[model samples]
Target chain A: MKRRLLLVSNSTLHGEGYLQHCQQHIRDFFGEKVTRILFIPYALHDRDAYAKTARQKFQSLGYELDSIHEAPNPVDAVRKAQGIFIGGGNTFRLLKTLYDHNLVSEIKKRVLEDGVPYMGSSAGTNVSTVSICTTNDMPIVCPPTLTAIGLVPFNINPHYLDTDPNSRHMGETREQRIMQYHEEPDTPSVLGLREGSVLLVEGNKATLLGTTNACLFIRGKPATQHEPGADFSFLLTDTN
Target chain B: MKRRLLLVSNSTLHGEGYLQHCQQHIRDFFGEKVTRILFIPYALHDRDAYAKTARQKFQSLGYELDSIHEAPNPVDAVRKAQGIFIGGGNTFRLLKTLYDHNLVSEIKKRVLEDGVPYMGSSAGTNVSTVSICTTNDMPIVCPPTLTAIGLVPFNINPHYLDTDPNSRHMGETREQRIMQYHEEPDTPSVLGLREGSVLLVEGNKATLLGTTNACLFIRGKPATQHEPGADFSFLLTDTN
Candidate 1:
């Protein structure tokens, strides 16, 4: 069994419904084999409400969504899950909750070892990287560590925005922030996934999906943009 | 000696020189009696370059700036400093460096108890609060703790921007992020200091200085905007 993952930059595009933009990709990635998904709604403040919302969305897509918060044993829930979905919210809160519940390793084992299909958007996509260091979410809570489940070789910066040439905002631009991230010693490359973009990975292959271009941040080099449908499997190879 | 502090939202406004917009406020906060200032350039990646740039800026303001990086004894440098300035870059890196050098306590003691006039902008302003939890900077590096020098009762979110009603960007607005910060149990209020705004604290009283209005984020309440020169001293009292 191969490691299958659908890492979306955001759950919804500007005018789309919940996960509407990536619905086809989600269907194709999971296929007809997986009927149920263990939903991790810990990233959100209202876990029950978030789970309820996600459950409706997944059910509309013809899959049963069971929230881990409702499970008596989250670890056992992950162990038995055929597919896993982590919703978007605060990355720090999500990581902290996962660490607090000791579900990090179980989720990793289920996804990587047991070949359970994994899907995440926004905060969910961020935690699938080498570390949540590149996430754009506010650090509302401090996790035990910055280490995350490295489903992918590189870090994912979800909701990556281009520098607005006409804007006078003094806050660091998305590119500038990613450049600053590279300043850290031994930092890995980062994928600036634009809204509506998805990184689909199967075994050792990774492909950039969607209509927009994704920005890539490499250490000691100028950042480059990759168009949709480009092969990003090279990112899996250790750059260090 | 009363504790005097100048917390600026940004170092430079649009098309202005470094610290150009707030130079007058800087001089006013420190006064003519304080000629020599100790500078902390740890927030930036290029510490030496950042220090040199800030040194020139302070010199232009008629004060000698000595970077702590160049000081043989950092703690001693903080102890004997007439004024302290923390230049903005990345808040996490700044706090980490301070914690690594064990300068958090010394700087806190000097600014809070010793009445050595302290000035900070952007990341600098964020750290002068209860914690760096409300900062807008990317977490490039993880500090030992999110705890920062508690110079003020509430946290500061510098370079805070108003939500653009016309914009289609799906990223959370600055206000939304601050509200999410408040979602954490018992989190303090967050002052959304916009660009060109300054928070001037003298002992028990804090005033909102500069030309623009600053937004205040109190838990479970609608965020309110405060005009320039507003009396924000009430923030010092226990809100929880």
Candidate 2:
């Protein structure tokens, strides 16, 4: 069995409903086989509320959503889960919760070893990378370590924005921040996925899916913009 | 001895030279009696170049700036330093470097116990607080911990900006991010220091200094706006 993952840049675009933009993709990716999804709502502040909202959305798509937080044994839940869905919120809080529950390894086993379908958005998408080092969210809490799921070879910077040339903000731009990340020799290549963008990976192959182009950050090189539907599988082979 | 600190929100304002906006404040904070100052340039990607540029700026201000990276013993340098200046780049990098060199405690002792005049801008200002929990910079590197110098009682969110009402960006506003931070019970009140603003501390007293108003975020309460000359000493006493 090959590993399958759908990593989205954001849950919703500007003025869009929760998971509205990616509903069709969600359906197409899972097909008619995946009926139940083990929903990880740890990224959100209100887990119950987040789970309820996600349940409504997933059910409307003709699927059952079971929140991992409500499970008696989260690790066992992952082991038994056919599909996994991680929502977006605060990356630090999400990663910390995952570590606290000791679900990191179990989720990896289910996704990488058992070949269960894995899907994540925003903070969820960020944790699937080599580390949470590229996340844009505030570090409200310190996780045991920055090391994450490493489901993908490269890091994903979700909701990646282009620099506003006319803006007066003095803070480092998104590109400049990624450049700084590359400054550390140990850091891997980063994919700056624009809003509405999704990276679909199956086995060793990955493809960019969306209307807009995604920015790729290679160490010591200029960022290259890849059009939607471009084959990004090359990134999967260039591991740190 | 009373602790003295001048924490500027940013190193440079738009169209301003390096340390240009806060040069007078820097000079006033460290009187003419303090000529030689130890500089921490670890926040930046290029430490040597950052140190050289900072040296020229400090020289123009009639002071000799020595980078801690060049010191044979960084801990000893901090112990003997009359004044300390930390420049801005990335808060995570700054805090990690401080921990790597084991200089956090030494610098805290010099500034809090010995009353050495301490000044920092942007990322530097963020680390002077209880933790680097409210920084706007990307998490380019994972430090051993999020714990910082704890020189100030409350956390500082430097280069804080007001939300642009007309913008189409769907990302969380600065205020919203801080609110998410407060959702965590252990999180402290955040001071949203706008660009060009500075927070001055002497002993137990703290004052907001600059042309613009600063925003204060208290858990379970509405964010309050404080004028430039407002007394913020109360925040100094509300330690986590």
Candidate 3:
């Protein structure tokens, strides 16, 4: 079976309710096929509270959500999950937890071989890519490695923002950070997803969806932008 | 001999020339006893250009700065240097280069045991701490470990910014990031150094210096703000 993923830039937009803007897209992506989702709330500290919020949201969208933290056997939970949803928080913490529970390979097997539907928001989106090198989160915790699920051919930088020319902050901008990643040898391409942006992938076809355009970055080349309805299928096959 | 360090939050302030904002502090930290300084320009991509920028700045301050990358023997140069300066860039790239060149322990010994004066800006400041877990830079590359020089007992979050109430960005604020760091077990205290802020440590004495205030985040405790002249000496020995 082919891989399927819905990578969201953020959980909520400014002044919007949680997942409100992307509710329709979420519904359409999961459809009637997935009546339940295995939620991974490891990115956040308060697992109970994080799960509660996500459970309510998914419930309202006509799906049952079960947090992996509450599971007696997380690997078994992934194996039985019809869908997987990873929430946003600190990427390091989430990835570390996944390793601690030995769920990386199990989840990968389910998503890749069984084609279990997968959806990730922010830190969640980050872990589905080649590596978590492009995440904007602090490395609050250290994982054994920077490797991720490799659900996508390239890395995903969620919550990507454009440089504010008038601002005086001296830190590297989002684009500059991605540029630095490109400097490393054999680094894969990176997709910069702006607020309210989502990338939907089904088999070999990938589409950019939501309110904003996505920035595609390749090594030795300037970054290019894609519109909401743009086809990103080429990204799945292009290794260079 | 006392461990001497000047950890700056940034290399340059808004609308200022390189190191112009902290030139006086650099002078006071090095003093007349230190005539030449060894420069580590590994944080950035262009070693030659980074070295030139640092060399000229240190020269204007009456110190001869030699780029370690250009030295015949990098570790030997570190052993002979009166002062060490690590310029700011991507923290991951900087730490990886240090490990690749086998300079971590060498520099740590020169500063902690030999009492050689150490100055770091941005990425440099992040690496001088216990770990790079609190840095704001993207993880563009992977180092062997997030372990740093441990010159101080705590982590340093350089270029830390306060949340803007007017902004709508949903990403975690600098305080939130450090808070997450505090959530990790056995994690050290984190100092959030705003742009134009500097942390000066001479032996057991650590002081907050420069134009901005520094925020201290201790586990399970509310973060406290310190003024420019505030003494942070307790941070040198406090493990809790």
Give all TM-scores, in the order shown: 0.98, 0.99, 0.98
Work out how many backbone clashes candidate 1 has.
Answer: 0
lDDT tens readout by residue for model 1, B133-230 = 99888888999999999888789999989999997778788887887888889999888999999999888889999988999888889989899989
What is the per-residue lDDT of model 3 for residues A67-89, given as tens digits with 9 covering 90 to 100?
99999999989989999999999
Instruction: Write one digit per residue (lDDT tens) for candidate 1, span A1-240.
Output: 368899999998897788889999988987899999899999888988999889998899899999999999988888889899999989999999999999988888888888999999999998888899998888899998888888877899999999999988788998888888899999998999999899999988899998789999888889899999999889888663
Residue B139, candidate 2: Cα error in Å is 1.9
Candidate 3: stretches off by over 4 Å: none
Q: Candidate 3 lDDT, tens digit per residue, B102-161?
A: 899999999989999999999999999888988898988889899998888798888889
Please, what is the whole-model Cα lDDT of each candidate in the order they appear? 0.89, 0.91, 0.92
Question: Could you arrange the candidates by DockQ from highest to lowest?
Answer: 3, 2, 1
> Which candidate has the highest DockQ of all?
3
Ten residues in sequence with the least summed lDDT for candidate 2 chain A? A231-240
